[model samples]
Target chain A: MIGYLDFVIALALAGAMAVMLTRLCLGPSLYDRILAVNSFGTKTVLFLSVFAIMVGRADGVDIALLYALINFIATIAILKFFRYRSLDVALSQMTKRIDQVEGGQ
Target chain B: MANLDLTQYLDYALIAMLVVVGIAIIRMKNLFAIVMLTGTYSLLSAAWFVSLDAVDVAFTEAAVGAGISTVLMLGAMLLTARDCKPEGKARHIVALLVVVITGAALLYALGDMPIYGDPNSPVNAYVGMDYVAMTPNDINVPNIVTAVLASYRGFDTLGETFVVFTAGLGVALLLGLGGRKEEEN
Candidate 1:
């Protein structure tokens, strides 16, 4: 009863996952891409858990939990690293170009 | 017969919510709105699982997908920009093709699956009996889901944990010591 219904729900959500993938591929900004990927991760967790029931295996639940943790931690870390090494920071950095422009120009 | 009962009504409701959330994730221009759609997607999925009598699976999905994943996405958003750049920017044919191919292959394979809840199905014959038959001495856990996950399939769960550890290590390496703005003090 509920099993078939769950299958329908999982299927519909998978459709959403497809849309998120579009954003990940066609994102206009880095943050958009990050958000899309995070959305994808959340869906993956649900997909795995539903799969556990579809197959009657409890192991899938454990795997979903592991995946969810990984997705969250990775998103934050990547964003932080980007900020630390942003292109603006690179342009502002002291270099030979600064000396040459300051001295010659 | 049983599926056509109240369960179908519930199923229709869940499917409606799922479709709505799916559209929200894609159509929303706001980054937070998209992230939030993902959260609702998780909760709806958890509810779906619960309806299916897989409460343990529902619990995990609710906790991890609805809980931790949202926080991480928010943190990631904070670390960088918020609003997405203007739309209509990048090429995406390859990814679409891949997703389509994969979905098609899976659906084709699933067509051969045994009937739902068939009594003579191998899953019911070879597998389902153990949970009912072996609770007393073979595994001590009252909850069959816990027993199967922790003992019967213990090694597989450990492998999953290993993957989480690996990801955590990777995040630690990537972020270093950077914190939010004004935290430099």
Candidate 2:
């Protein structure tokens, strides 16, 4: 009985992923694409969890957890890189420099 | 059909999603969109791996593909143009022909391989079987994959770790540990 439920849930997630991919492909802006990518990662995490249940294994949840962590970090890194144009800069330092400039002006 | 397993439908859907993402990645010229689509491609592949019951491989794919590679590519993109230059018309035909031929060859080759999860397949029948049996008795690791990777294949894992360390060192050397020096007055 639970297996059927898992299957149904997995199928719905897959359908949502298909829609997300469509949005990703049709995006008129980079932000739209980024949003799509992040949402897709979330769906993947959920799908992995449901799939682990469907397959009657506990191993997949470990992977799903790792993916959830990495996906969030990657999205942040992408946004940060685009915003600052560099990865190594400290965010606080950048904000401080901005404040200094505003004070000087 | 009543006999059809619903999970198999999910498999087909995932496969279809993968193909569509791949085509989109190819057709798009914007580097940002392409990078994002690549992540989508990686996530889809990881999910597919889960469906195939290869959790270890799926984990690696999710980490390396969806995470590390996406960030690395974005970093690399910062040094390059935002959009790809238009290719000459002649090159497209040649590229398409090569792709079609290679794809056809791969499809033909696929028929020769054993079906997925076939117990009688050579990979599952030989050393894999030994590891499965030995893992419980010798290592007492409930997860045979962990045992085989850490114990049975210790040297391979060590080598992979070394490769990753070297890559990290190279990147640090090239890019520096700290942010690029603030522009001089």
In terms of TM-score, the best-performing candidate is 2
* DockQ score, prediction 1: 0.07
lDDT of 1 by residue, B1-185 (tens): 54435454555656776786787676666775566567657766775676566666665665566655665666666576656775452446676788899999999999889997898888889877877689657887778767888888889878756655654444444443342233121
CA lDDT of A15 in candidate 2? 88
**TM-score for all models, in order of appearance:** 0.54, 0.85
Predicted structure 2, TM vs. truth: 0.85
TM-score of chain B of 2: 0.82
Worst 10 residues of 2 chain B by lDDT: B167-176
**CAPRI class of candidate 1:** incorrect
For residue B96, what is the lDDT in candidate 2?
88
Give the per-residue Cα lDDT of candidate 1 at B6: 45
What residue pairs are clashing in model 1? Answer: none
Per-residue lDDT of B1-185 in model 2, one digit per residue for the tens? 32136667887999999999888888988888888888888888888888777776777677677877777888888798878999899999999899999999999999999986799999989999899888888999888888988899999978767655654553453334565567632
Compared with the true structure, what per-residue lDDT tens digits does model 1 show for residues A18-51?
6776665457666676677688778777876775
